[model samples]
Target: MWGEMLGAAIGGVVAVAAAPVVLSAVGFTGSGIAAASIAAKMMSAAAVANGGGVAAGSLVATLQSIGVLGLSTSTNIILGSVGAAIGAAGASEVS
Candidate 1:
């Protein structure tokens, strides 16, 4: 529905807007490193989630250890949710 589209748009905007702030706050100067780390962590979480275990905590820990100090608990949940939604949509489209 239109509401979902609006929500997704807002979420995308928030994620885009927050990315730089997060990277700078976490002391990551390289986009490549940030992108790689995030992708790896998200993939790890996906694996864990598929195995019937929640990986959000592990993902958060990994991000925190990598200096993502500005990434709050809510941010982790939002990011994870977004990642999951994207994956599901892609899978459905491919199927």
Candidate 2:
């Protein structure tokens, strides 16, 4: 019970503290992600305009081509797991 809380606290702190160093070492940045997403959206818009077809599938495929869809899915999964962990830790304390 308490152990889980301690584990969550320590793990959260360590992950937060290490994330910047890890991200920087790997040359990942929020700005880069945002720029890529904007580029992908623009590309999708251009493709739709050129194709003269407003099919949603075409836009999805265009975004997927730029890895936008895949990255977003993976990010959601990772964040969901972290949220679940944090939520569980809190629940344990209440119970």
Candidate 3:
């Protein structure tokens, strides 16, 4: 768990740092997919925190077990895209 989070943090740091320069290039679709991936990761991590483990395919198992983050597809799409765009922009200014 620690390892995974640390890795994410490092990757996120770099991604956030470089994301802005590419946001315009990433465009709507790319940002949307990125957001969805983040949502999935967050939900999976939550599951792991509640009971899941640090085993291989644990996140997949968690997602399969819970059946979506209780959010509708449309909502996910809008939220993810918007969130990703804003997050990337904000992150770029951090460092």
Weakest ten-residue segment in model 3 by summed lDDT: 24-33
Model 1 residue 84 lDDT? 49
lDDT of 3 by residue, 2-92 (tens): 4444444555555444433343233222223234454456545766686864344654443333242333556445545555555555555
For model 1, the stretches where C-alpha displacement exceeds 4 angstroms are 1-70
The better-scoring model by lDDT among 1 and 3 is 1
lDDT of 1 by residue, 9-74 (tens): 656556646665676554443333344465455555666776944365665445544443445667
Candidate 2 lDDT at 60 equals 38
**lDDT of each candidate versus the true structure:** 0.55, 0.50, 0.46
Candidate 3 total steric clashes: 0
Write the residue-wise lDDT of candidate 2 on 1-95 in tens digits: 76666656655555444544444333333433233455445545766687853455554343333343233555545645575578557757767
Whichever of 2 and 3 has more TM-score, that candidate is: 2
